[model samples]
Target: MSDLRDLYQELILDHTKRPRNFGQLATANRKAEGFNPLCGDRVTVHLELDGDTVREIHFEGSGCAISTASASLMTEAIKGLRVEDARALFEQVHKLVTGASGPNGGGPSLGKLVVLAGVRDYPIRVKCASLPWHTLCAALSGGDETVTTE
Candidate 1:
């Protein structure tokens, strides 16, 4: 268990130091901004949808390691997924990080995103970890107002 935790920590730090898909997408058709006032984390999620599938996704922002890594991992996870699938994935990840899913809940595997499950241990950090996901939801829903974790 300790080894697994260390691996998770390493993965998180890797994503934080060098986030994947971190940039603006010139061809993005949908975008949304998010702010976490609790920790002053801000992020913008951009997406290019090919019909109902996400053809590309990117994000740009300055935030805590958790926020940045979550955005990075999210973009990687959702890039080739259909919008509906991505939304479902968001729900799964939300449950994982928020401790809403109990042991043996048997949720679908989150793959690389399972690393985020650790955030549930830190109540306040939960907001930091979820900021990007909330922003992605806004972009998917075509919301113009900035999403806030207040």
Candidate 2:
């Protein structure tokens, strides 16, 4: 368990230092911003949808390591997925990080994203970790208003 935790930590740090898909997408058709007032984390998610599938996704922001890494990992996870699948993933990840998952455990395969589940141990930081996901949700729903974790 300790080894697994260390690996997760390393992965988070790697993503934080070199976030994947971190930039603006010139071809983006949808975009949304998110803010976590408690931690002062802000992020914007951009998406290019080819029909119902995400052809490309990107994000740009300055935030805590958790927030940045979550955005990075999220972009990687949802890039090729259909919009509905991405939304479902958001729900699963929300449950995982909020400790709201059922006894069956992690509640489906979140792959590398499971690393973020550790944030649940730190109540306040949960908002930090989930900030990007909320922003992504807003983008998917075509909401222009900024999502806030208040």
Instruction: Give the candidate number with the greatest lDDT.
Output: 2
Over the full model, what C-alpha lDDT does candidate 2 score relative to the true structure?
A: 0.89
Q: Estimate the TM-score of every prediction.
A: 0.92, 0.92
> lDDT tens digits, residues 44-114, model 2?
99999999999999999999888999999999999999999999999999998888985333644799888
Go through the candidates in order and give each one's C-alpha lDDT. Answer: 0.88, 0.89
Q: Which ten residues in a row have the lowest lDDT in candidate 1?
A: 101-110
Cα lDDT for residue 115, candidate 1? 83
TM-score of candidate 1 on Cα atoms, chains taken together: 0.92
Q: Report residue 10 deviation for candidate 2 (angstroms).
A: 0.5
lDDT score of residue 82 within candidate 2 = 94
RMSD of candidate 2 to true structure, Å: 2.3
**Model 1, span 1-150: residue lDDT tens:** 885473359889999999999999999999999998777799999999889999999999999888988999999999999989999998988888888986433155688888887787777788888899999999999999999998
